[model samples]
Target: MFYSNSWTKCLICLIFIASGNAECPKPQVEGNVVLTNEALLMNDFPEGKEATFQCANGYLKEQGSERITCTSGKWSTLELTCKKKDCGAPREKPHLKYEFSEEGTLFGASARAICDKGYQLTGPSYRQCYATGWSGRPRCDVVTCDKPPEIMNGTITEKPGEEFPEYGGVIHYSCNEGYTLIGNKSIECNEDGEYNSLPPECKDVNDIPLKPTATISITTTSSSTVPPTIRDVNDIPLKPTATISITTSSTVPPTIRDVNDIPLKPTATISITTSSTVPPTIRVSGRNNCVGEHDTKSATENAAVVGIVISTVIVALIVLFILYHSYKRKGSYQMGEDPSRTKELLQFQNN
Candidate 1:
């Protein structure tokens, strides 16, 4: 009974001693970091001791002692710190834009990339945040198109032998002489590596028959009045030319006149006018539709003929007037000089 009572008394004393008699203060939290959520469980802590530190989430430990030593009656000043990592701005790419997911450019973050219209993403489209920095460096470039199709009897207008024409680039075509252009005159290279239209074809101008046409223009006076304006809608021809002549009472059409050749000016004019009883007559034997937009509006065959006719009539009238005046002067001179002599000579001849 005596031993049991003694043991009970010693246990009570030990409990009272370990109850953290407030002899040493515990360590407090530091710099936005918290330790275990549990209440201070230490029964007692002696001077010259240590307690560990921990960093909160999304923060890294700085280069310092993670534990703080307890000195006599107080805790040591904190040596450890929690800091954040920063990856500065990313590199810029042409025609491309980027945005970060979070305001912080720290590790484990990401960035989204987008390209402008008519531009394509060539390299990685997205970048991820790493400890060093952004992982991928993306690129942007304009949409590309391949070489246009070759044309038959025609040539495309492009830099010779240049392979690629980017999107929205244009190509023009022109046919050889006597050949007409079929399909589009020009095509555009699109982003799909194809042209907007098929290649144009050149047709032989001589394959279609042409008829004779007559245009008679006469100028009675020297007036500034514009003669009837004409627009030719004919195709242009190529080089190496030869003259062709056709004669008829109707309008003369030089056969196979090169569509590419510029029409020559009339060589000369001739005038042939009949009496007023006859009006000028001009005839066109065939269909007459002049088809040429580029006009070499020099004097035509009919215009030359009209000018000749007017000039001839004026010359003939002047000649007739001069002859009549000469005849009248001769008769007047003979009458005045030979009136007296005329009677005397007649009488002598009769005897």
Candidate 2:
């Protein structure tokens, strides 16, 4: 009896399926469209029933109706068309530029933020487009550097009101008096927000290397009958009572002399006095000392030049005096011969 009942139900289902009275499978449409919530909840759609559709999450309907009908256990042709949603260009920001993906600004597309030269990106580097809009806000900030490093005995020459230096900006450095700069005088801010090189050092001038020292020695002698005071090159006075004597031996006997009918021996005495204080030693240690030594040497060279000039002048004067005397003698001899010649001419005419 149960097999008879099952056979009867199967016969009825076959009759219904043959008559095209069965429900339609889940309705589907092309172009990224999906069934509406009401339609999706229903497990099946009967013939002659309607199903509504809408664009997918990141898609938008372009044209055609969102409703379709099922007939003969099959869905009707869908006239709906959809396209990707567009987010358009990103917001504008200073020093910020945007580069879009291959999909452009459409739905699911991404954009990357780029900063101008000497600038840094502060926010997220990438943004994605969605049905709502772009993802995040990105910004570009100017690159800056902190205050330059300080140097010993040196100072930075900053602008009037500048506290922090920007990228590519330059700062100059200077040393105090009597100090020498040992590195670059100016450093520039780099793209990394730091100085291009380390700060220079200010070293004392005395620390600089010095050339070899030179020593000079000089000797002088003098003989005089009278007691005389002597002075050094600096004009410092010397003792007046010091005496110096020199003796020489000759092959010939010394000549005797008589003064007022009294015979006397040829005896000579000489005295020479020199400064007692020794000359101060000159030490060339630093730049100032070397300059002083150079000045002294120049002074000595100038004095020597002046002495040569004076000697030349004296020699010229002596030559002029001799020439004058010889000219006068020639003129006198010529004058004396003219009178004698006139007397002889008178005697010849009378003959």
Candidate 3:
């Protein structure tokens, strides 16, 4: 009976040892909290054992202790709170602005870079937040354009000291002498780093048209009651009245026919109109002469004929004057009294 009691006591001791060694399942905490290296190696925790925790990657501890105790095969409630790490704002740059992604400025979030007006972004346009801060370095640069196009017979002028034009820059154009510009004289660089329009052309001034020349005209009219009559030089008749009408373009007075030289019919009427630049002169022979409608001539032609006749008369007068003086010096001035010579002189005067 003593041996049986010893075996029973040994069995009871084994059961107590089993109950004292109770273990808790792998530890689990809310949020980004995770077990330390030493605690994670073990699959389960013994009763009364303590485990330490910290924030997960990209997360930071916010509140409460980092340690918890296991009791009665369960882990103690965890009070540790964690949140994502914030990267804050990006670095400031000239003509550059940033816009955060949907993840905000926290760790692992991304941002896009934007340039201001007349500028462009260079290098990477996107940057991501990391544990060490934002990644990538970007820059904003002014937009630039190549040399402006050349125009025919024209020159382009730009600002001094500039090899190439920048955004918003202006260029002036000019044409050579005797040439006119055909388009805008100035051009501006656009946001795309190009001229806003095509270069202007140079047109020759001679291409312009000139005014037309004025025209000259002539008109004539005449009136008579009976057919024109030709009179003989020997029969002298009373001077008849003549109605003369003259029209001319020149400011100078027109040359009219002498009343004694022109013997016209009583009912004859003459109207002359001319648009010539020069005034016209009219003359008629008195001996054996008659002026009718068909006798009219152009103002220019009449002027030329009158000039020739006046020149001939002047030369004949000079010759007659010299001959008379020579005859008087030779004592032959009585030659005019001879009957035959007198008749010849009268005939010449009539002609």
TM-score winner among the candidates? 3
**How does residue 292 of candidate 1 score in lDDT?**
38
Please list the C-alpha lDDT of all candidates, in the order they appear: 0.62, 0.73, 0.73
Taking all chains together, each candidate's TM-score versus the true structure is 0.40, 0.51, 0.52
**Comparison by lDDT, 1 against 2, better one:** 2
TM-score of candidate 2 versus the correct structure, residues matched by position: 0.51
Clash pairs detected, candidate 2: none
Please tell me which model should have the higher TM-score, number 1 or number 3. 3
- Candidate 1 segments exceeding 4 Å error: 1-66, 70-83, 102-107, 160-162, 205-351
Clashes (candidate 2): 0
Q: Residue-wise lDDT of candidate 2 within 1-351, one digit each (tens)?
A: 999999999999999887676678887556598889898888878878899999898998899998888888788888888999999998798889999999999999999999999999988999999999999898988788888788999898763245788888888899998887877888888888888898888888666554333222233444444422322223322233444444333233334342112223333333333434233333322323333445555656787898999999999999999988996665442444677786785577568
Relative to the unseen true structure, what is the Cα RMSD of model 1?
22.0
Ranking by TM-score: 3, 2, 1
